[model samples]
Target chain A: MPQLKAKSLEMRTPQVTKTAVLVIGGAEDKVHGREILRTFFGRAGASNGYITIIPSASREPAIIGGRYTRIFEEMGAKKVEILDIRERDQCESAETKASLEACSGVFLTGGDQLRLCGVLADTPAMEIIRQRVRAGQLTLAGTSAGAAVMGHHMIAGGGSGETPKRSLVDMATGLGFIPEVIVDQHFHNRNRMGRLISAIAAHPDRLGIGIDEDTCAMFERDGWLQAMGKGSVTIVDPTEVTHTNEPHVGASEPLTVHNLRLHILSHGDRFHLYQRTVLPAVHRISS
Target chain B: MPQLKAKSLEMRTPQVTKTAVLVIGGAEDKVHGREILRTFFGRAGASNGYITIIPSASREPAIIGGRYTRIFEEMGAKKVEILDIRERDQCESAETKASLEACSGVFLTGGDQLRLCGVLADTPAMEIIRQRVRAGQLTLAGTSAGAAVMGHHMIAGGGSGETPKRSLVDMATGLGFIPEVIVDQHFHNRNRMGRLISAIAAHPDRLGIGIDEDTCAMFERDGWLQAMGKGSVTIVDPTEVTHTNEPHVGASEPLTVHNLRLHILSHGDRFHLYQRTVLPAVHRISS
Candidate 1:
């Protein structure tokens, strides 16, 4: 019999995490010379990179696409493509997949998380994107609603509160790239902690990550999460929480949870998911 | 064939977590009306409670144990006892186990978490304690080192830093009441966040909870962990992190992680570990 204190429980951790993902909580300050965008470009390779922008999450894809095209191009990306697919069938087209596979990095602009997941989830285009990322050929970046959809358990919509309560947050399925977490955008300005907590309460054992405006939590394939931008990244973890009155209450009832673990991260904060710890990062050297 | 997004892995979650653990992170102001102690008493049945204090974690067990004995008695506990097991062999004595089994609550004092776990882990006394807790007969409370030993993954020793780095924190097996987390004491005042982060990084999937002076993160049988203190409880979660350079570093090499989630909880904050969220608690109604 194993000792009661033993912790190796045969966890089925992810096998290959060779891709990098940027989950940027939206309304990033572009007037500040787009610091976050520039960083993404650098990660994708500043000079010899092929960058693709997917505007599917936006209502006006062409406009959003056009705006990012200029930003990335100006950042010295060798080739910036506005990846487009007008219809559902376009997602299955070999031409689109091939084109996506050729990119060094992909960016999804802000709009609606549901809209983005609705268009791209389980599609041939998404398959190619995942393949490229896992194969170490591409870096995937998303902002705002695009960022929200990065996790497997996405927050479709929710109301906000200073203190956490149940039923305040709503949830929906997403692309599942970051399945163990639920990402929220425009965190502090909207005061989304309450809703984020509710979502985490519903999906027990998963993490709730809220990114502030102009802030980004970047994920590398090895499951290392780092914070960047002017604001902070708020993380809500209910894994060690000992009590929650959620199951006993009605839909509109307030939540009561005890022992929830949380973390607040800013620039130069590094976290390893596999090791389950935080490491402080030194300032990035400007290339 | 399994779909790519399948989250249903056969996770071997710990088989035992039936007891209520109140892991207090130390320096709790007992002089100021003993608010946390009062709350603890209320959980243990208040006026009709049988409370036991184990000061083995302290270098001066007698003094530390006496202090708590007086507090619990003053709180109107029906009976207060100082459990004595002088010899290591006494741990196997049926008399010791029986005496401990009678108490409604057990409070462990602060000093060295290692010594506490060393003396009690796998002992017959501990076996009985677990049995009683599993049967919903006892509440286990601990402070400082006592608090640290509440989790299965305990931080044995570590150096503090403002930024996280490799080899800063050491790990050891604990008593295992709260297995999913790594608890740290004297958080902010001592600048222990750096070490706490390193500890969390060393053990992935488990949460890192740093409790500050005069703070208590109360856990009940319902899996709720609540903060009742002047300082905050900092939570570090790397479960959603995608990458970290920890595996590649030496003792002093700065660590790099991406997308780490964090939360800072002060007074009135209640966290649910399973739900992975924090809920704010209103002031308690005196019993």
Candidate 2:
């Protein structure tokens, strides 16, 4: 019966629009960071929302999917399910497409950012997510490596705690969930500042956001970023920077820059992403 | 006799190597930024230096060339001549090619940055400058637009006084004298922080350098950038930046970033380009 319905919908384009992106830094304790999850659940319409957990970023997708399945069910999501597929080809199957088309929320588990982007970027599954997000039918959420892959320019790998220099970080294409910013997860715990700096300096026009190990930066449809969890979110603004030596120095040379403005926002801090303003926590999108 | 000899050397491969680039910010005032030019002259063997003035970046190349010719002569150069051609084709001329071959130093006058790169970026004259500089035979000095085109990425145009936003500035390829930095001139006087930031955000890996109206940032072959002039040189180092919104935001959206390390160096300040350290003013390369 479900197969017959899935085939019928093949002729119909999926109408899905996303409302927000819940990007969690790595090490988000599912227990302590449950409110962040609950916020997604609540925004997803409490017990009535249709949720699909994508654990493809993990090596053990089945195990991770089951874990989230129990968590969401326990959290009062009545129609919770998991998409248990490893191959990119499964996204094209009528069953998977049909299931995803009805989903009101999608959660991605953390593992390898590249793995996630490799499977989903430019794929049918990815297109549905984008279409749904643009149509405002779903809220997307991801953690750790999942979060890292949200931006178009993903930070693949780099060293930490060193001085900013040339070729210190590796960058690659990411799943275009959050298109304007470069997102780095597990930033504080991994001491990834040096690499993050390299990423931003390499493309200073993009906003760089480093989410701490336990934090989440929830980007709403209206372009507001609200912080959640115990850790901080570091914002690197190179817009007002006076100079950078990255383009002048040698490949292995140390880089010098002048006048880069910075901002560090903690949980409860609210930022207007479109207007680029720092609003008080309580002043944010309160229902 | 010197002209004939120069013409002969034109056919010979100009074995030129430059050891350093003396890039001056615009409105040099000859008096305030005179020490920078004096440093170049002194480093090029003072009165014994063979100098060629290329005023191709200027609209009035002949007048600009004549002015620098007299300045270099008055400054006690042994030989100072001009390559007064405006078209790119003239770079193939025997006289122009030979004159540049015998030059131990080249002084590029300021006018239009695009003009400078347009005429010199891939021209034979440019190749000679790079070859000579690489071989340590010539020291090139450029002011204003001449200075702006020293980097691999040039700040073509942008707005001022606004917070950093997407597409706020335009960038083009530069003269490639220095391959790692983005140079912006008349920084403080013209209030160019916004455009500089946009340029840096666009290419974060390339260090952004905004030279003040009277400042000079001398990039030595030893990987040290020494600051010179009345005003400060702003360096926007994105290596340590934690986040940037440039990749996530829309065309009209404002950009926000976090933790971009900045260094504002004034006269006498010396920074190690490879190590990215601020050295004591007195602790510099004492020739």
Candidate 3:
């Protein structure tokens, strides 16, 4: 009876979004194979796609915006526009909202997360993007600082290569594009396990996703996250944690935690977000 | 008129405790000159003192507890007792409470802070020690992990050598011996400036005090903290901070903070805790 109800619900929602969010860690290869970018290009509908680039996070928005525009255009995007919304007021403009409305995909470039948030947060353009993404009308992707802002609870900056503790990372609000997890980019390359673990300890309800340099954790509308690129994606699940000293202990004390689940996913590996289960890659049976 | 009132109060209280809290960083000279320990011994009333050493933080309590006992005995302390309580139940014992009550001075040795808190926090002996220290009836000194637990907000453990952000260190509730500040031991020797700054950013209300190796920051009853020994004490005061991204940014995000007051005090230099002022060392009049 439950299966029948779920099947009916799924049938009713025929327009379910299949496009995924490409969350690339910093330092992704752009010149060579460009596998991640190529994947994004195909997912965004190639020649039929109208891609918009938001480079507000960079110090030189034009340079970064032009870079992505060329990359997407070279990959056969029909229309590529650089929104370059430098000011917060620009985010409220009709032209900005129209650009986003027409965009099949949006790419947020890397630079300073605080700058990105300063320009995009709480504006009409951002609201429209959020709504469209939720409605399966747009595919969104960000890299480096861009990837860091995908989660509702963002890791702005903090130190790495230490024991996992409350004082190991700094946190702030993000764009809320993906609200269920806290994302940390340039993971293992920068030794950010301690930072991610500390973040998870602070917000146990949210999963901690640490993406290594050149890696991507693509989240699909069906709630399955797939790992891509050369490096791996680290998932820290705090749901099974039996005990944590976070509440009783003060701000900077070493933590005592028990039963945290961790998973390292490489290319082609898939994980169901809600179910908290991993799906190993299926090997091709060559006859 | 205010001065007259203060004088009157002072006249009424002739037995004001002259003892100070000797907060030593890790690796104080145990064999060499023993300058810091000797200072502590004299302030603890030398030959007339009944000093109690708490070595619960150490894995081998008896070894560490005996080491300090011998040091004090060598320094001519007539009475020295090792109250090495390993269990929480032992902290509640009558003997533990009696030892703390009879002692004129209490010394906490270096070890694992988590273990120390597990054994001592909320126990009968801990409560007695807190009350006595507050009432100025007992002199208190701690080193390394001992010094780490002096504040209401204690830094348990975290990384170093990074930008000052919210996640650079871990904090937990300390013994609250000195409630107004957050203490970090083995400061400059370990390149912990960033760690201390992060701690201050998280807790602007509490001053971040970083004590270097073989150094001591002694807090007197009059609210003056004096630096002693070879290295300097870095005091980070967050009261002047005009802006901080801590409230808005997510966990691990790089923080943007402005106008934090910092002071580095060497041997003989003093800082007024409540006033948030620094007093330079007084040169000797050799005439």
Candidate 4:
């Protein structure tokens, strides 16, 4: 059923996504500037924000949940709740749905992506969160594995430090938070270019966005993506791919792809996802 | 179209797979013993065998193709032809079709699984190969990347040192020579248990077969798989899996799966593919 829904979503003519999603690569600055987290806190209405932290993905849910709760509380958020979901059935509880409905912002913590999806996929709590985000009634942010689950075609796991080969990247169904794109977190630091390229080679229709550690690729409702934090976001656009030896080569062998468009964006740079173009950064006036 | 075909193949009630397929892990003892290759040669009718070596997966197609051709010829094969397919269009040619139709056995060499697929997938030559294979007219044996591409759900590449996380395995569409199982070559030698397990977690319906170096998982028309060579064939059966936190965890986090039945088969051991049971090896009286 999700596959059918995804197909229909893909078939629909391009429209600006109403949801604002902040996708952070792994190891985001928690102690330093906290520019990314601070940006997310402000976007969620700051003091008026009612935040929900979903730490099911982490092995130490309480610790991870408490960590983020304190961070948001220190930032002066109005209210924050830790949704400790241990089992799939817990997601259907009325209390869980209610918490999601009342929240202005939701944060997904880092852990195993498969575990996160195992508990939340197809659950009513996740459904409500998705509906609210789509309606532009909520702001959502996720880090590390949280960021990896935002696409339809997820790069679940794969090898790095190798040539881009069909065997280098592992893919699984994703949460479809941003269906038009495929994302990889902790990109450059892990030397994950080969895997990402391998992923894009398999799915040329989707835009490949690789977020480096400590970086965030923030998606706005207006369809422009803004880069924030210290690192950069690398985009691999395969629209012009004339030929690819992806299917021709064997595992561990190098892949050959022609004419892939690449773009690297740092803080303040913006990219239009649908248009597949980088927009010139305009000077902002501080009020 | 291939997806539809694959789905239809999957939907069919499990019947005894008539095609005899030899799936070898990488680095099978090519120089000595050569038990695996010799078995394939014998299955193809030994001295009367008309063989076609497909080295399209290798970068040096000519050299790899010649190596197999000589090996087969030295074993007293009736004839051997190296099908040097460099382009997709070549698969549609009459010469290509004729050569495939004429061969009693087909040997796909190792290089890059993606490259092998790019040239052969959905092509007329490949279709003939499949038709013959299904009709039990041809014996097919592939090693390394060749072995990887025999299944419908192919493990293209992935990381090994890490735990079995959803992010550790990369999968792609394979040639479907044996769609019922997913194969990974050079298994324990490369510490690929994690990737293979991750692959099975994603596709619970398919049996996960990990062939070790110098090993082979031979599928007979009778539907029983016999292990050959020095190393063992590890089978990860997910049919009894009651629970998995694969979808619940985030990327890089260890996955939790319960009730997986595992069997490691060595030389002469046989396993029933569909029934999900190990068959006792019968003593053979030498002629």
The fnat scores of all predictions, in order, read: 0.05, 0.24, 0.00, 0.00
What does candidate 2's lDDT look like per residue over A122-239, in tens digits?
8788889888876778888889988998888999887642345556678999987878889988765565655676678777787788887667898888888887765667676567
What C-alpha lDDT values do all the predictions have?
0.74, 0.75, 0.80, 0.80
lDDT of 2 by residue, B174-199 (tens): 98878889998877556675567667
Q: Indicate whether candidate 1 or candidate 4 has the larger lDDT.
A: 4
For candidate 3, the iRMS in Å is 17.0
**Chain A fold similarity by TM-score, each prediction:** 0.89, 0.89, 0.91, 0.90
Q: Give the distance in Å from residue A249's predicted Cα in candidate 2 to where it truly belongs.
A: 30
Which consecutive 10 residues in model 2 chain B have the weakest lDDT in total? Answer: B278-287
Assess every candidate by TM-score: 0.51, 0.51, 0.51, 0.49
Q: Name the better of 1 and 2 by DockQ.
A: 2
Off by over 4 Å in 3: A1-17, A283-287, B1-287
lDDT of 1 at A175: 84
DockQ of each: 0.04, 0.10, 0.02, 0.01
Top candidate, metric DockQ: 2
Between prediction 2 and prediction 4, the one with superior DockQ is 2
Q: Which docking category, incorrect, acceptable, medium or high, applies to candidate 2?
A: incorrect
Residue runs of model 2 more than 4 Å from their true location after superposition: A1-287, B1-19, B31-33, B283-287
For each predicted model, how many residue pairs clash, with residues at least 3 apart or on different chains? 46, 76, 32, 41
